[model samples]
Target: METNTTSFFCLLLLISATVTAFLDIDELRNIKYGIDILNKPVLLSTQGIDKQLSETIDVTSKHGQIYRCIIPSQMEAEKQKEEEEKIAMEAGVPELLKPMESGPCLFKTRDWWSYEFCYGKHVRQFHMEDGRIVGNVIMLGYYESEFDWKNETNMEIKSRNKNRLNRYHSQQYINGSKCDLTGKARRTEVRFLCEEGTGDYIARLDEPETCTYVMTIHTTKICHHPYLKLPSQQKPVSITCNPAVTDQVYQDYLKE
Candidate 1:
């Protein structure tokens, strides 16, 4: 009885060795094997499977192997954003700011008291005070005409003088307050104040009279120029009101 059992055990060990020799170790490692209810080898994961088998299994394939479908996070976000912008534009939503076209353009303030003209990439601003231009006008490319000045009717100039004084107490009063272009007759000059009540006026003609032109304009369209810049705030200077100091010293110091 003992001899028969020993022979049976040796036969079982030989069969096990033969089966191990015949199997490919690398091929077995490449497969994802699992056990089914009947204890049969079943495929679990399809990654690295042959493309033909992957397709049959309804799996994505890449380079003869199965692969997971994926998209870059940033690429997905960019695509979604592009579609949204396209839809918004097609819906007729106007942009808050429109890019300016190249070349000369006019810009004005909301109150229509300020105007800016842009040309050759250069920008200049004109400000009005008390119905007259109080700042530099020559910097704005002002020129005097050689022709005689022709006065326009009050009715014709009324619309142009809106928000400006029309009637003054006397000619002397008007002269005192109105913009004076006398010095501007020959050439353009800066740091000059216009006639007091001439804020609504413009130099329409090169030389309306001997060297002056009665001009008026009103529009807020000039404010949209590309070269327009915000005005800078003026800094206040401290002054020492000394009794011993002469008036000339104060005046000179102020100029400095």
Candidate 2:
């Protein structure tokens, strides 16, 4: 009987040690277990998940109570910074815009056509039918610095009213899919406006002439900035796309 009792106690100890090894003592301290009026167990934590930091506690559960504590100096500093950014965003203060090397493409769909703008990279126009791309994906334009914006269409004349500081508000996207009508590569000029409070959005797109397009974007990224700087000088923006999935819809469209 004594031998059986000792084996059972040893098993419990082994199980306890294994569980404790997997759990952070600090986290266990922060978590509070209790029963509600309905007899259901509940957990309460003094600190948020994101703000949690772990520190070793020499004492085990046998000790009266365990608690989680952190060196407040570093955590306090981070909290202050997060609060300041939240305040600035709420106040509509223009924060420094992020480098436009990579981000999710902004999409806008209109009657019978959909547009995708991969910022600082490329633009695409595609038609969809019955929830599938119906025709060839039209590359409106890709990023190119040396493309003569002046010879093609005078940007200076377009933004004549804006000051010199705002001259860079317009960008040229050149060398797109060949246009059957014009027998030239389609191109687009993306113009930025500061009307919207925040966010990058393609508000409007129009094809004024065959194979030539104009796109307008509304964003607060450049709201208060006197000078607009293009990040294209840093390096060529890398563009990536998933393989186009061809199903029965695509096959039918090809036949038509």
Candidate 3:
């Protein structure tokens, strides 16, 4: 009789433990099947569960539990940024060039002429008199859609050690205002250079030929690369002096 009672108690405990495990699993399942505010489906993964609970409103489930399935605001922003970058790269855009694509224009002004360059867009030259616009805008060039910027490797610079050469990137803008003299449309060649510790800006602009323009831009984006360094950015070499020779020299100078 004692042995039968012990076995019956053990069976009851096993059934209780199994029922408790099932209840816990059912609660978790309810949490995972929450409704999203955006009406999109939510994943049931660990990270997804955390997002759902944090971003959605609680709703009653059949098990008398609250559940939600909304993505967090921070995670949504990150996903948007990543998608934009991916699209930009697929269009042959460089990472450093993205910031300039949709912001204020990069400009440099010289005597009576202010040159404005909108990256991957257009270039304009206008006259500003006494801080106010005075004359019609001269379109230097518009962005050339057919140009392949990724393969543009024509610009080269010789390193300080003249034997070494480095290739850089450039943009060619064309189909601007018609040139009176050349009988062709004006064009501009914008060159980008890597200067350490400087923000991106138009360093200089010149009309080298009739209706032909050259614009130089300096930026830090291209820094740190071996082949992208300018001739002036050579690494410094350290010098050392012998202590005994220095002492002897000091003594001779003192005697003199």
The 0-to-1 C-alpha lDDT of every candidate, in the order given, reads 0.29, 0.53, 0.57
> In model 3, what is the error at residue 140, expressed in angstroms?
0.3
Write down the TM-score for model 1. Answer: 0.16
How many clashing pairs per prediction, in order? Answer: 21, 0, 0
lDDT of 3 by residue, 144-255 (tens): 8533444545352233224433334578899999999999999998877667688889989888899999888877765533344455322221111111123354466557
Better model by TM-score: candidate 1 vs candidate 2: 2
Q: Clashing residue pairs, candidate 3?
A: none
Worst 10 residues of 1 by lDDT: 167-176
C-alpha RMSD values across all candidates: 35.6, 23.8, 27.8
Better candidate number, 2 or 3, judged by lDDT: 3
Best lDDT among the predictions, by candidate number: 3
Q: lDDT (0-100) at residue 192 of candidate 3?
A: 70
Stretches off by above 4 angstroms in model 2 are 1-100, 129-132, 146-159, 162-168, 227-256
Per-residue lDDT of 82-158 in model 2, one digit per residue for the tens?
A: 57555544543123334344657888989989999887789899998887888789999997742233343445545
Superposed Cα deviation of residue 110, candidate 1 (Å):
4.1
**Cα deviation in Å at residue 29, candidate 2?**
63
lDDT (tens digit, per residue) of candidate 1 on 211-236: 32222232222222211111222222
- Candidate 1 CA-lDDT value: 0.29
